[model samples]
Target chain A: MPQRIGQYTVATPSRPALLSYAAAVGNKEGDGPLGSCFDYIAEDTTMGRGSWEQAESMLQKTAVQIALKKIDLAARQIDLIFAGDLLNQCIGSTFGLRDFGIPLIGLFGACSTMALSLLNAALAVDAGAARYAVAVTSSHFCSAERQFRQPLDYGGQRPPTAQWTVTGAGACVVGHGEGIAVEALTPGRVVDLGIKDANNMGAAMAPAAADTILRFLKDTGTEPGDYDRIFTGDLGVIGSRLLCELLDKEGIDLRAVHRDCGVMIFDRERQDVHAGGSGCGCSASVLCAHILPEMAAGRLKNVLFCATGALMSPTSSQQGESIPGIAHLVHLRA
Target chain B: MKPTKKEYDAMTNKASPPSPKGKNSVFAFLIGGAVCALGQALLEGYRAWGADLETAKTLVSVTFIGLTVLLTALHLYDKYAKIAGAGSLVPITGFANAMASPAIEFKTEGPVTGVGVKMFTVAGPVLVFGISASMVYGLILWVIGLFD
Candidate 1:
């Protein structure tokens, strides 16, 4: 059963387990620092698909398939699936998982989709609403570029603050079985600090991450030293630094325990990714590929996964609206 | 206390690395000059092949557009533009690429709704402003003629 903890945290007494997980990434991500941790590295960005959208769909499908195959579970055995992507209306998840015939709940948390979906799936399983649930999310560089910025072949110079959208997908299965335990969760509130630059999303999203992490630490009555690692989704270099500075103002020093998925995914100097990797896939793949596996291998005992997202559309940004950011936190135990 | 929005923006600005304007300007000047020099060479070549001055100029522009489209298709122009920056962007070749790249990207949507509709998305603004400015100049010239 799940019970409300102090303020925003929810404590799952049963601690729903993550049975299996997998990550699949494109060539660029496959060539990154954490490349070997990924379950599948597609040499072809298209995955033999005609369009980038279809390729993103294939990424999701491959991730889900690999996750299920590891646990020896069929689609019919799973009761619910929560999935999303950085595509319009989440077409990547909807179209990709359509063949599975499982009951689906579509989510749109931008880059925070992985944590959002996992939180929901864990809650559902903890409450006995489902026997097994799957959480998945994906993002593609070409698809995101076309929709948000410019055409694939457009030759506009990128600013130093701009982050490269990762081309990858990650999926995880949650059930009431022995595996990495989902102990607690904290869903973030929307925080908008009037950040208007679409290129500098790290600045936009850092405040939200700081807020959620503060609340989570306060509610849980634990210090940064309690957790082996605290993972933030796709803050890159700028946001990660800003996050530490923001938390330092409140006398909470996160410098020692903090690690960002965006910063971990790429080799900053070797890769042309200016700030680091952004997008839903960045955190999702890192969690499924690196974080969870580390926990399963007994290397990490306690971890906090906080994925942040900048919730602004192209139309809103063009209308001069500030980017609102959100971060969802999940406390996992080995 | 948490910083105000204005304060936070300032902090973010300070933390972010500034774009290398001096380096970019040097690259732009060299690349842009080279592009102009190539156009001159092509124009001279066309003239030597027995074309008039007007025909030679037209041929040079046509050749540049053709070459740009080919480079864009081969996915090589963007890599060049990454280093060349405005050097590649301020040329007629850039205008041709602006039209061609979107056409190629959006072709997945369909020929009519995708390629045709989006073909002018980037270059349309330049055409609109350029023609309007020229018209304003012509109107001013006519007013001076009337005064005379």
Candidate 2:
């Protein structure tokens, strides 16, 4: 049974292990700073698919296959799979994993789907609800652009605060055996700060990220210094800066310990990724490709992985509704 | 103490870097001028080939739209547009791209619902306002003629 801590944090006494993980990314992401960290890089983003949506589905399928292959486990061996993507109806996950024959719980946390799915998988494993659980999430630049912003070939200039959607996918397998331990989890509340600009998602999500991180730290009785790294999912440049500023008001100095997956995934100056890499895959692939690998190598010990998400759609934005943001936290120790 | 929504928004604005407007404007100007110059050259060429003024003008537009559609199909227009910004956007070529991109992208959803419906998504507002404003202008001109 999971123990309830102060406010929203839940302590996983059993500490379910993260058994295996893998990441697959597109050419752009593969050319980035952490390019070598990924298990597979699709030189052709379409993966020879007829459409961008199908290409996105292929990314998810490839990620899950690589993850399961790492531990020599078949898809049937997985008890439950929690998966999601930035596509409408999460067709990326559904179409990709449908043939696997494993039961799946589809989530829709936008970019935070990676962390949200991971936290749920960890909790379920800890409770003995399933012998093995898999968490997976993905995003594609072409697919996301057509759905959220503009057509791929549309000639529009992106603002300085606009983040490039990462064309990648990540998958992780969780079980009770030996691996990185999932220690604690903090589920976030939907925080809306009246941010209406769709381009500035980092700013829109920063408040929720700060709120969740603060709550997690307070509930766990841990300082920023205690964790080797506190990773925020896809906050990019603006959100990362704002998150530090917001935490500073509470007398917590997070500047030194904080790292945003969005910021780390791309070389902003060289890649022309104005703000930084974003979308569900920005955090998902970074975790599987870089962060988890670093932890396994003994370079990192205790870490807080908080993935933030902007819960808004094109319809919602067009209707003049403000974007509501959410962030979920998971504490991992090796 | 937690800051109010207004305060937080202000903080966000303060933290975000401003867009490079001055540099972008220069690029936009150069690119937009180049596109216009190409159109003029094409018009001159058509006229030299013995076409009438109206025929040459129509040929210039047709050639530009056709070339834009081809570049869009080859996935080259967007790359140029990224650097050119408004240079590529505020032209006859831009309108062609606006129509062609969704047609290419949503073709997987089928010819009818996907390409046909989504074809006007981006340019629809521009078309709507353009036609509406022209109607208002025509109405004002009709009123003036009656007074005359």
Candidate 3:
């Protein structure tokens, strides 16, 4: 059995190794700062596919393939796969990996799917459930827009608070070998602050991020300065600011080390991304492409990665249901 | 971790209704009025060209739709929509923009599924209700005719 640090699950006993990772993004993302770090960028959002959904599936498939190739491992060598996307029933994961024939666990944590999958993969490896596991998730802007909001051609003006869903996928392999190791896991509880505005996702998810981080610190007896960096999934500009304010109320300030994946993925000034990037791919791509590389290069030693999600559907929004948010955290040591 | 009832209430209560009423309404009025005036001008142009009232009206509608789609493709209608609000939304050009916007956006999805399927996303409901209302009105007219 793995040691429990209060409610936090310690992964030291299993020492699940994060061996390799890969990220694939769309052309718009390729124009961003971390563009060069991505393994591949599709020429267009469609990726030459018949539908945006199909293009998203291709993105996930390519990410998984590239991740496996990085470690020189075949699908057969992997014991399990954890994947998801911001599509109906997670069709992106199901259809994309269907050909691989690897036993897969489908997840739906909205934008938090990436961290959720990573945390699950690390735990599974620690529990000796699999020798090699993969965590993957994807999101496509066009597909997400059609599903969650208006279609692209609706010419609806995106409010300043609204975020652009990133079109990308990221995959990482967790195994029992030498590399960056997953240290601990903090699974967040769903928090509903009764925020009904679908456009202001950052504000909706900020309290959850703050709650999860505060809980993790409490449970582990750690301070905010323990980690070199604390990265929240896709809180964007507004959410991150709100998170700081909330944490200030809790008597802990993370302003110095806190960086959001949403804020980091795109150049806010140059890119037309209103608030910032959001979706499963936002954190997934940034972590695999930028954060992990920094760790491997010994530029960073410890990181707290927390991905937050607003668990609301179009149906829920239409029914006037408040958006519930969840944030999943993983401690990684290089 | 669960927040206390007080905490939850505080968070939810903090939500403020966000809007700049005076500015938004002004922009909407100006932009929406401009769209309607354009349609009026087009209709008058056709009438001056010696077209009948019915023909002139049809030409005006066609021209509005064509111009809306062209603006949508150029990504300018969204800017107008932002300022005009319901003003831009109330005109026939708004409906055309609604249909054309999704079609152009989904063009990369291939003509069949992408552009074809999503073409009706915004306008579908309007069309359904519109046709149904007209049918019910026609049925009433037939009933009145029989009574007469």
DockQ for every model comes to: 0.81, 0.79, 0.35
TM-score of each: 0.99, 0.98, 0.89
Model 2 clash number: 0
Most lDDT-accurate candidate: 1
lDDT by residue (tens digit), candidate 2, A76-134: 88999999999999999999898899999999999999999999999999888988999
Candidate order by lDDT, highest to lowest? 1, 2, 3
The CAPRI classification for model 2 reads as: medium
By DockQ, highest first, what's the ranking?
1, 2, 3
Off by over 4 Å in 1: none
- The list of candidate 3 runs beyond 4 A from truth reads B1-30, B70-87, B101-121, B124-148
Clashing residue pairs, backbone N/CA/C < 3 A, model 2: none
Model 2, residue A237: what's the lDDT? 90
State the lDDT at A292 in candidate 2.
Answer: 95
lDDT by residue (B1-148, candidate 1, tens digit) is: 6889998999899889988999999999999999999999999999999999999999999999999999999998888889999999998989989999999999999999999999988889999999999999999999999989
lDDT of 3 by residue, A23-48 (tens): 99999999999989999999988889
Candidate 2 residue spans exceeding 4 A from truth:
none
Single-chain TM-score of chain A, each candidate: 0.99, 0.99, 0.98
Q: Specify the highest-TM-score model's number.
A: 1
